[model samples]
Target: MTINVIGIGLDGVVGLNESVRQIVERATVLVGSDRHLRYFPNHSAEIIVLEDILETIVEIRQHLDTPNSCIVVLTSGDPLFFGLGRLLVTHFPPEKLRFYPHLSSVQLAFSRLKIPWQDAKIISVHGRSMDELIQALQQGVEKIAVLTDHTHTPKAIASLLLALDLPIDYHFWVCENIGSEDERVQQWSIDEAKQEIFAPLNVVVLLRQSRIATNQSLDLANLPWLGIPDSYFCTYDDRPGLMTKREIRVLILAELGLQPGQIIWDIGAGSGSVSVEIARLFSDSTVYAIEKTAAGTSLIEENCRRFQTNNVVSIHGNAPDILHHLRPPHRIFIGGSSGKLRNILGVCGMRMLPGGIIVLAFTSLENLHTALSWVEERKKSDRSWNYRLLQVQLSRSIPIANLTRFTPLNPVNIMIISR
Candidate 1:
């Protein structure tokens, strides 16, 4: 027996093709919301108004137990577009299910706007955190489409975006009653949209603003530091910037090389840059930022708050002395230890599993040699051990010859010793 989930579009029955209609007609029992259920102008399938999903599952199972049982679930506008298709697919194996999909509401929204959606960032804030949606927006993606909910309605989004100091030039297109007789599409600026009322059912599209956050301060309020001139990153006098430049940060964090449910230890965490960035990128992983110096500890905490990361634990204790007490971590990052290179590496080296990684952030050749010698000694054992240095040089943009050009920035040497 096959279970089919057909995608319904905003155009209602008119949008559905002939094949999907046949699945509905032959379905032993049909399941959908009343509005969706009414689409079958003529059908012999026993209409089952959906209420509790478990009840529907039980009803389907009962039908399946008898003989030939075919269940067809109908949804509006691409069942996979924040729809019930996922739930059904999870409950039934793929071999037993077939899906007929219509263009997703997001596709329709972008189509109606005559915009290419391939590059657009689509988010469903229906039952999600407003912060996530706002973060994605702050990253300055080219286009954004939001599937809104009653509590997270268009008005609510408009109001929140306005509070975020959304640019005045960016266009907000509120699509309502789409593919319906009473359909109304309203366009407004962020300020105007805050007051523009619309029905509960709506999709919101945010077009790229003519200008970026040129005037916004570099703070949590305005994130991803997008469009901010290269002058925004906080650089220490005569020293490299606290965090890896944005570009390097993205790459190395990619290489911290975490596995699912893995534990990571970041020693000598200065400003918690690596730790905070990793936490933000991999929200599910646990990151420990170890720092001892009063200034270093303060910097780490400040960065954690600055990056808006809730995943890192900033430990104010010193290393080696602190390494002994930690539950063996799967990954370790030693940020150029002040002393006890052998002792700390021995302890961390032993703590890690067979293939676990141990990264060392070192600057000076003396420190790098010391780290290499220690790892080399350990490599003599049954375990495999190796070390590397990340000679990172970063540059940022500045006005030169009346045009913004990247200048050679700071350089740092990061070493990775792993087995």
Candidate 2:
């Protein structure tokens, strides 16, 4: 007894062609939600409401022994995609189930907006947590499509995004009742989306705004002398939210132990968050902000200008290769190494001034291990060489309904080295 799982759209029965209509008409047992069953009111088939999925599956199994059962399970869009079809497939044999798919809400939403979805990261907050969406945003995915529910509405999503205060901005589109008569696809700023109400059946699409669009006027006087917000700096559009957090930056600054008229090197500067802060605090110090990527170097200059840190020299080239050309550093902060950790560390050790301090931050275990290994090798020759590792974890408060909860930033291992 084969189960025919037919995918329907908002248009319902009228949208079905002759072939699929015939399959539905011959059903001896029909299964679907109340809203879906209402579409075929006059059909002569034993009804099964899809309220409790487990109970419905049990009922369907009972009919398998009966003589020639034509079972038609109706669902919306592509049933296999975050739908009941996946559950059905798990219980039934592969040969017993057949899927007939229609355009998904995401598909319809993207079509309405006239954007390609091949590269879009699709996350369903429907009957699930918002963790996936949050992670995707943190990773700086260029495009995202969110399937929403009563709890995780478009408004709620916008609020969460705003609370994050990310380095990059997004163009938020609330696509409501996608294929229905009153369908609406409107773009709103993150602030505007938080205030507006959207239909229950909606998809939220986010496109990472261009670099130019993300630039906002800064009030330097109002900004803090230390702990500047991550959003203040101009970050990479393709890789937003990549800057060192304010808390981590403070920790790194303390680890460096800066002095007047000193030379500081910020290798893999990445927006020069730390470099700008150092330049601001010790105006007499010349901070060389070294970055490999052209985009990163440009951002360093922009952020330096915004913070009015004239002492931060944005050097656009790879580390170790470019480190030799610059003056030896009294202090160094290696935020990134671009997989050349050993080579960079060797050059820094050779060129570092006496009593110089080097602070390296690592988010991955592999990099942390590599740094430790390098230190161990160097310590074999010089017993005076020393290192201290600090595992730093920080979280910020975000509002969930009226209450607040903490979302942790990425854990960082800070290796402070000195001789």
Candidate 3:
């Protein structure tokens, strides 16, 4: 006996092609939700309402024992596209099941809007957590199609988007009753979506307005005095979390002991997070953010503009080689040394202004030892040179079901060297 999973749309029975319609007509048994079952009320098949899925599966097993039973399980949209087909495959053998997929709501949604969906990120919050949707938003994906449920409605998603205070903005589109007679596709502002009511069957689409953050709308006065949130700055597309996190940035900023009119060099600046923060704090200070990758340099410049930190000069070149062209620094931050920690340290140590402080952040023990060795070798030549180490470990709270749990960040060992 084979379980034929036929994909239906909001348009119901009339939407099925002749070939698929014949399969449904010859079925000896039928299983589906109340909505899906309503499409074929006059059918003579033995009906099973999918209220308790485990119980329904047991009934299906019993029906399978019959020698010549044809079981048809109805589902909405493409059965394999975040639908019931996955569950059926896990419980039954591949040979015992066949799938006839209709157009998915996401596909219908994009079609209604006349938007190409090949690159769109599809997320389903229907009877599931919104963790994936939240992560997609954080990443600032170009396009997204979200299948929502009663709890995670369009309005709720809009509210969550506004609350995130993201660097980028999205054009919110709600497609309701897609592929049905009463289908409605409308674009709404993030604020307007919060006050409106949408149909029960709806898909939320988010299209990023721009690739870069909207810096003109940024209210710098409202920003924190120190350690700006990581979300405010636009890092690399591939390496979003590569920049110095806020927790560690705070410690690095404190160790720098920043003062006005000081020259600061941020070596291996991933996205200029440290440079921008220092520039914002002390406008008189000049921050030279040296990054090797062109993409990294572009991101550093973009972040500088986003935060309106004009004092930050983004330099696209490797450190030590690039350090010689710049003015001697009163403070140095080594966020990344690019496997040349010794050379960077030698240049920084020799060129630094008297009483200048250098803070290096390391996640690897090997790099930490390299810096320690470099400092020890330098201490013999200069008695005033000395270093201190601080190991930082931090964790942030995250929701786990009804309770909260702590998720630890990467451990960092900070080496502070001063004369």
Candidate 4:
């Protein structure tokens, strides 16, 4: 009833220690992939190919019931690191299992490149979505090590990075067949990487290039933070102060109840002030800034770079027209909706997660009434939403002729709807 889950390096059986080698030799039942089992062709143990994980678990359970039986499950790299060891431990009793881990492929790859990996972000794309990889890149990490599979190869990763239009420069290192005689490590630029194919088993490492200092260094310390001065943002020359005011933006952010890993949408994101702040507040979250005007979209991009908010993605298109293409959001902020306020609200209400929050900032009574009517209509059918309205009127102090005078700013109506 005893089981030993051992990790094997890419070098195969030769990489095992004496104790692990003896355990494998004396095992009554062996479980692993076909490639792993081929390493012990002359062994007399009962070999089970791990084609279906569920079926293999059932088989292992049956074998454990037999008296005086020893089971050894072999996996690549560190068994507990995105490997079968953790899964087996979850299904089986912990006291009955023992784990012997080897250097992980991530470690071997980093070692081959002579790079310190303690600070590097490690991710695995084997039989998983590439979204996590994209998110990591957007976070502006200095270095990353990605474990890739056949479908999510190094070349595909390179193409995805290029498509995102990432501002930071990166050098891609493709490490293939690690720890074996046929091992290969090659460095490539983003352009050169997309043109070549790599072995199915490989690790893709992205190292950000260091930036050179210039006159622009003075602005680095003045990066905007929460409730940043409105003057910091670039607005249309003719339509200055068009963006959300600092005071109201702080309130809207508080109402949205931002959380880590949540997806947020900023419709009609003028200059993307709100979206950039949200990305900064929730560094792990994804923020999509949907703006229609060409100038507005350009401003958002410029602001994102200026603020070093790489997590914010600016979509240059009208909302409700392009909302269908984006992932469902946990929080949505509507700054300007043209006349489609009702339609945009409906789409957001439908796509937002249950218990999600939606906040709208309207300067016109017509838009405010439109939102109120939509909420009232939805309330009749579904009572799950809670609504609150706040009107903000403020004045700023300006010094004139050695005397301070108060200048009143435009009033805004904020409508918050939460499910």
Candidate 5:
């Protein structure tokens, strides 16, 4: 018998599909993280907390090749998002893996908050950084939901937002143990949220549209990243520039349709090109940048300072991991995800507000195909998701036979999503 990987959303067993629930209940050998296993501690199935997933995978594989072993791997939220189902599929064929997914924890958070989440930006900042999150806010995304780990507490998130000078009057909802009997939900001001104790396993919902009447450079909905050029500040390289293209960026911004002071995430910020422009466009908004590269993080700070925008905050870390720990956003974008597309979208789908918007930029067609496949799957369980294709061609005046021609560069794909 092969291993059966199960995805446990916020509701734990209560929200699981019948087949998935049956799989967990009937499993003779259950393996999960301590927290996940504890959710079903009373189950008669034998359980083991998997601390080292690599080691656990190896052991599970050995048993999978055996005759009578019933192995089940449990995960928090969507296993495909930051969960283990995908990992198992990598080592084995599709036929060898069975995935049972539940409504993600972020979904439960939204339900508890009673906010329509169709258009929210959802991200998991568990072990990743907040650079991207900051950038998104600067661009004016309105509603955001964050899947948090232990370190990315609401207080830590609040401190970061304060440092960035985001509007202090926005609403903050910290939901603990969503879908569980002891579930607790608290709403507070940015300052007030800093004093509370939030559960390690929790979710954050941020509402960026409080006063609704602040005037800014760009419409909160049309906030653009990388709108301002990289040459506006220092950079690690001197070629094309350490930033997303302005023309395409403008379209992405147009797609976002953000509001003033909305929460946003710019994951994998290379040079704060997106973050700075977002801050500049929405002076009242707070933008978070998640950059793992040292030069990139430094560049974000440098650019923000050079542009005199105080709404940008750069975090030095990776995504999904770092993303899980930060506050959620009304708009979420993956500027640089290091090829972790499945995990990225899973987190986004799980954490995005029901009515939130998500934008994914792809420079190549192959990746665009892959992203489409992933997004298509998300549309199945999730609500209505709309996709748009923007093929941009820009030209600069050059001495081409005494004439400047607008040579079409490779087409870039910008996928705008609405939940």
Candidate 6:
């Protein structure tokens, strides 16, 4: 028995090559959606409409059990790219299945727009939450290609983006019925897209507009590992050094062990220095900068705009209270907890995913003791809990008259707790 998984685009049978076409023509059992099966009305194969995915796999196996059975499964776009090919492969042996991939709708969408997609972030909202789309937008991706479904339509996505008040300016392109005769590619602003209806079969492309000049340079490409300097952030005039110093920020990020696509929470994100840096360092991750103070929240917004760090979402509310609404975090940085360090730690511990990390930066001995006590309490409950403490003292060279002087920064106590 030989199972051939063929990928078909909107062009349908006309897009198949001779080799793939022969495979489909010779198939004794053809598996595909009603729409795809209609493309081969003259074929002699027994057409099986895909309804229940697991049931379909069972049917495929039943055909394969017979001698000299030739089965062909038709899927949309590249079979392995968010397509049914991956699922079929898992069910059948590698030697029994052969794959013939067609260009994905995402590829077609980008081709229609005449834009390079190498750097674009590709996401699918089909049978998934709209949160993926929001996360991509928040990441400050220059270009994004989204696959839409019946529920997560272009209009629904547009409405969400508009409601979120996305910090970056983006031009939305809706590519409908790609490769078909009635194919349409329309570019609109977010406001325009929200009011318009698009075909069920469509792809949405988001292209971020160029940034305007500001006091802080938005050119993040050439920055070093430590990220943007503290001077770049918009701190309160009265509290100049309120933001995390560059050295401490670097160490905290290292200890947090950030990975792409992870969700991070920066509680007490003052000036959003840590949040902005995390966003920049991990472009695929989403950062929530939670601040209670009005001044801190405003500074965070200002710094995010200045750095063009759209991925860092600034939440203006007290911790633990607002933490419940956010998704479980992979990494959390507690930079300021007011006097509620224990409560914040408790909420984060409950909400963090297994193996998630929490790093707390404290300037006062009292907060450090509170965090240490919390860690001790957690260890008693869960012996698998591990923690470490590091004291970082940084000094920078400053030119005084004709001589350079070293200015020592305040020592920061960092407590890392991992589950």
lDDT value, residue 392 of candidate 3: 96
Ranking by TM-score: 2, 3, 6, 4, 1, 5
Residue 29 CA displacement from its true place in model 6, Å: 0.8
Per-residue lDDT of model 2, residues 96-215, tens digit only: 899999889999999998999999999999988788888888778999999989888988898898888887778899999888889899999878988898898899999987653236
The lowest-lDDT stretch of 10 consecutive residues in candidate 5 is: 211-220
Model 4 misplacement above 4 A? 212-419
Give stretches of model 2 more than 4 Å off.
Answer: 212-214, 339-343, 364-386, 399-404
Going through the candidates in the order shown, the clash numbers are 2, 0, 0, 0, 60, 1
Higher-TM-score candidate among 2 and 4? 2
Winning candidate number (lDDT):
2
lDDT of 6 by residue, 1-419 (tens): 78899999888889999988989988999999998998998889888899999999999888988877789999998999999988987898899888899999999999999999998899988887665666565455678899888877887777666544433456889999998989999998777887898888999998876421234355566766465555456665534546777778889999999999999999999878899888877878999999999988988888778777779889999988999999999999999888999999999999999999999998899999998898889899789889999988886653322234454678999999998
TM-score of each: 0.51, 0.91, 0.86, 0.54, 0.49, 0.55
The TM-score between candidate 3 and the true structure equals 0.86
Clashing residue pairs found in predicted model 6 = 138-311
- The TM-score of candidate 5 is 0.49
198: Cα error in model 1, Å? 1.5
In model 5, how large is the Cα lDDT of residue 240? 26
Distance from true location, Cα of 130 in model 5, Å = 1.0
| lDDT tens per residue, model 3, 1-419 | 89999999999989999999999999999999999999999999999999888898889989998988899999999999998889888888999899999999999999988899999999988988777877787677889999999888998888777655555668999999998899999999988998999999999999886534534456789989897877677866544557788989999999999989999999999888899989999999999999999988988888887887789999999888989999999999999988999999999988999999999999999999999998899889888989999999997665433344455678999999999
Assess the local accuracy of residue 103 in candidate 5 as a C-alpha lDDT between 0 and 100: 66
Write candidate 1's Cα lDDT for 1-419 as tens digits: 77788888657777778877666777888888888887774667788787888788777666655567678888777777688877777777778777888888777777788888898888888866565566555455557888887677776776665544422234689988777777777787666766667886688998765333233344666455222222333222223234445555554555567776667898877656667766765778788888877666766676566556777888888788887776678888776477767777877877876678887655567777877788777778745577666787775443221234444544666666667
Q: Tally clashing residue pairs in candidate 6.
A: 1
